[model samples]
Target: MGEIWMIGATGRAGRNISAELQADRHRIVLVGRNGQRLAEAAAAIAALGGPPPRTLVTDDPLAQIATGRPDVVVNTVGPFGATTVPTAHACVAAGSHYVDLANEFQPVQSLLGLDPAARTAGSTLVTGAGFGTLATEALVSELCAGRPSPIRVRVAAMPVVDGLGPAVLASVVDAAATGGLVYRDGRLTRSRLGAHLQHTPLPDGTMRATVAVPTGELEAALNASGAGDVIATSSEVPTGRIARVALPIVGAVLRVEAVRRTVIRLIDRWQLTPPATPGEVSWAYASTEWEGGETRQAWLQAGEGYAFTSRVAAMVATRLADGDARPGAFTPGALFGADLARSAGATITLDSNAKDLR
Candidate 1:
């Protein structure tokens, strides 16, 4: 249905996005710094279904792509803490929609300024398309579906058990080292990771997820949602048959980057993780307390968070190609509404756990 230029298509998360989109018969154009990696991604995705998209490797991507053209450019480039401006500029110049898997908060401060330029250029720009806050944002939204006086949002996510690449490992450490973005008294503030804590429950049982500063994704999502008394947080959750016993230790480890760093080095050095698999699961729930009546709640458990992000990204690309989505820089939540976000392939849960809270 669409041609999406997939940058960093070989990364594990990027591959997952491509895998799901491939099932839908969407054509993925693999773009990366390396021709070899891009070719490998192209072949793999092509095998899934649909014709392989035009693969291009260029230092000057905009100059190179001015001719063949694409519907949208899905950037898989890491840390976008560094290279978003040029890519955003190129996408507008190429007349293509732009999306990235960036999670850094500093970059968004600058990118948000692109709203006017993007509107004038007629291009849609979205970043933080990764796993950071999309699911959490949706959870918070479905939690407060009805008009509620005040809503409380909390989230915890960690990849402690998964097979993480060096880059992924590096990103996690960097994000942690910088402490977290904290929202206080309606102002964006800062907090050290593991500074605050709460024991949150999972399908299995209860675990501790510390409160930290929300990333750009969470910040944008909450601001756009415009909920009353809303606070969102993301932290690591430890799981295992005997893992519950280790929550305190895990929580302690996450608090200090030096401690976490040693552990990550050991993980990398030892090959402790499983196969770098494409499937990743993200589960989130939210609660809403209104002025009267009863409180409402909703929870979501998903098996395909990575791919769904890609599928939604493809939808973004295709629409940008057709000139449907609004032009300008935005977070996924800034786009707003479950109906519109569905285009990004996020499923909703009707069995809200609003009642029965003691």
Candidate 2:
């Protein structure tokens, strides 16, 4: 088995992905900032009745990637706007394949923009290997596969997570700071945060209020569908009338660097988070409209968000370690198709009006 280095090995996503890889008898090296925590995680992995994982404690992840030069690096670190670029650059420089569960718009775009360099180095870089972008992106691809280029594409991600971590919160805050972003005329454009509020009907006959948010799904959907207009919304965003009214004000404050930092600091110190009772099912929907009157829609149903994320990340990492991936940057959906999510316990349902592209 190829050697794989897992950054943030002790974190939630890292722990789950490591367990998945280890269960398959893959050789893994747990890398984290805390030596004790990394050791503890390794112990837990060993206790799971597989090969014990090696440990590396380091604050400088780039340095570790450069020197240690593992065959593959799975970066589970977050607020990826700050970590993704440098880490990816290091992986390219070191000629190591890289994969990350990053769903932020900036980092996803940044990593995908590294195609030339990654190709030159013969290293594959996959981003948005998590529930954030993959689910919606997969749906977009499924809906647009047999059809011509769509004029408009709308995608929504509504994951039911069992819990939230500080990193996830930070990522949300960072996206909020970015305000509303949508692809228009094949270009990224700005709008108010929580703008384009609408009621999204889930597969279970339940309607959830969703709002426009800056997410990697926006970019992924555009690339996958080649749509001229695309909007990415999420059920995780606040959608009440009050929230809609206050979003502009909040978005303005977050745009200020100092204010954004203070808010993030407060969130961390206060441990402010939403409740933890996640539902058993997560839903992602995509609707595509061509120039005439034709339209298509699809629903991607998956298991628990975190569990599906772990499986998706594991599957992608396994493919990378086994040299099944091509040298370039990609979203899981763009690289592996919607079936990747199904293999990770997801189901795709198409509207009666839409053709079953699968």
Candidate 3:
């Protein structure tokens, strides 16, 4: 069995991925900042009738990865903007595979930019191994397969997460601070934070409101469809008229270093109510248009967002550890194909005909 080191093992996503890895017979090493929490998480893993996980309490996860090179390292920490690049670099230097559930645009693009380095180091790096990026990315891939590059592409993520964690909140804040982005004429361009508002039609005959956000799904869709223009929207963010008016101002304010830090601190200390699950299904929609007016649209349907993310992260880490993936950097669907989504308990529906492809 390959040795898998899970950073932030005390966190929700970390614990779930650790359990999945252990259940698959991989040796797990739980790494976190809190010794007690790490020990507790290890005990929980041991209770699952698998080999008890080893624990490492460290403030510098990069140093640990460099010193004790595990076969694979799964990072559940965020804002991934701060953590992803450095940690992935450490794993590459140590000749270890790296996987993270990062869905932020900057981090995901930064990590994928490491493709050459990872290949040279014989390491595999997977980012956005989660719902937002993977679900939409898989749909884009399916729509574009065996077809020419699309002229335009639009993707929407509507995840029904069960709860909110501090890390997630921090990531959201960081993404907001990064401002809005879209691919225009094959170039990354800045836009208003809540621009390109769309009412995406779901498979269940429901319409969900989404607004453009600078998410990794934007990068994923661009890469998958080779579209000259791409916009990634999400239902998670407020898209009302007032929200649209204020988003640009809020984003500008958060861009200040001190202000962002202060906001993150407040989020950490505040007692956030457990986010109620919005619905039973999470949907990701993608529409691709060709130059000749031919168009294709598809939807990826899955269960709770967190559960799918945990499974996708676990599956990616395990496959990397088992040497089942090639040496390079990629998002999950980019590396493993759309079938990865299906294996992680998602189904794809194509166009008005609503043909379900497993």
Predicted model with the maximum TM-score: 3
lDDT of 1 by residue, 39-143 (tens): 888788788777775577866666655665677777766546545767777778777778876665665655677778888988788876645556666665666
Cα misplacement distance, residue 284 of candidate 2 (Å): 0.5
Model 2 C-alpha lDDT per residue in residues 107-203, reported as the tens digit of each score: 8988999999999899999999989789999888888888799999988898998886777787777877888888889888988888988677776
10 residues in a row with least lDDT, candidate 3: 349-358
Report, for all candidates in order, the number of backbone clashes. Answer: 5, 0, 0
Candidate 2, poorest ten consecutive residues by summed lDDT: 349-358
Q: Which stretches of candidate 2 lie over 4 Å from their true place?
A: 266-274, 352-358
Task: Give per-residue CA lDDT, model 3, range 237-343, as digits (tens).
Answer: 89899999999999999999999999888887893434555789999999888887777789899999999999999999888878898999999999999999999
Candidate 1 clashes between residue pairs 3 or more apart in a chain or in different chains = 157-235, 181-213, 182-213, 297-354, 312-344
Superior candidate under lDDT, 1 versus 3: 3
Supply the TM-score for candidate 2: 0.96
